[model samples]
Target: MKSSYFTTLIQLLLLGAKNPIKLSTSDLAISIDKTQQTASMHLLFLEKNNMIARYKIDGDDVIQISASGLKYLLSVNQKIQSAFDDNSSTLVTGKVFSGLGEGAYYISLSGYKKQFISKLGYEPYPGTLNLKLSSNLHKQFIENLSNVDGIIIEGFTDKKRTYGNVICYPSIIDSNIQGSVILIERTHHDSSVVELISPTFLRKKLKLKDGDEVKVNISV
Candidate 1:
């Protein structure tokens, strides 16, 4: 997810600039709505990964997206759109899932016979992107049924700030359940969630319950 995000970030940067495509860390950070440090982190990783180019001409430092990054952008863009109307508006609301930092969030929903994550999504803030999963990707969730790591859900909130990384396990769910898990960007926190992003949508789409679980294996 992070890698794909970087691809989109770089692509937008390249396309938005004056066509020369020369940008500084500060410049890219502003465009992506990410902290300069976060932008730098991804940029440096892309550099080491042979996904970008770093060149210093005079006293100015510039970064350019490479073929690999462009290629990656192509793939990322594909997963960022929908076959019809994107329904990524659906989300799970609960406790934070697993991960470090108080910035990122993830939601995974399960069904007795379906998945709801779509290919279309949008970036509303610097560190966050809303995901709408498609039913086709539902199979991918099942392949991850018995693994570590939960999924993410989205909600509507004007205030988005967390003190630590959060793994929001649904304290409440339905009985005829499927699965559920939350991922936040904090180390830890305490709070009761009345409404997860799109509980209504997920309940109907993924067919989840209160006692189910969402887990995934990184490999295989």
Candidate 2:
């Protein structure tokens, strides 16, 4: 059926017609901004297509959306959500910064390396590329990303100390290089710092220095 017919079904739902409710053609026409005849025609079309069930109560017209109609609306809602998710992306600008020189030790550990390969689909380099947020707005974006779900790298224990969990968000740097922004459960850096991991040495690959500005497009 056409979208206009589905629109009428939505109008009925908004008028509390999901269950059997007394609804007049004049009322439906006003809600849909159509004439009474057009409203009646739409109702007939919906009933014939099994989108709505029509009956009577005490000689009064009663209409309700059927299971099939609800299913259609749910499917449309999912499609709309998917469309927004596909287009949703955040651009963050930051400057390259030096870390505590401990990224290589953590990244090279077998416990985290295996998960990085399996979950992230790529083996990360020995060291991480750290970035400092250029502004408070950019720092806020990272704070928001922490609340959402991302590629999770579970922590594990070996013969010695225990490692902490890490959250990674897939990102594109400079519009070409693919990487991830990682949030370590235990870290010395504050909220303004973002650590990234990639398959290659980001410093050499991107020709980056300690003060170079970069843009990362993160997919939430």
lDDT measured at residue 78 in model 1 versus the true structure, 0 to 100: 76
Candidate 2 similarity to native, TM-score: 0.67
lDDT of 1 by residue, 114-155 (tens): 122331122212121122223334435422332444433333
The residue ranges of model 1 lying beyond 4 angstroms of the native Cα positions read: 1-20, 79-220
On TM-score, the leading prediction is: 2
Per-residue CA lDDT of candidate 2, range 1-220, in tens?
7878889999898888778889988988999999999999999999999999999989989999999988988999899999898768888888998988899999999999999999999999999999999789889888778898999999999999999999999999889999999999999887798898899899998899999998889888
- lDDT value for candidate 2? 0.91
Residue ranges of candidate 2 with Cα displaced over 4 Å: 1-22, 25-83
lDDT accuracy of residue 37 in candidate 2:
97
Task: Please give each candidate's TM-score.
Answer: 0.32, 0.67
- Candidate 2 residue pairs in backbone clash: none
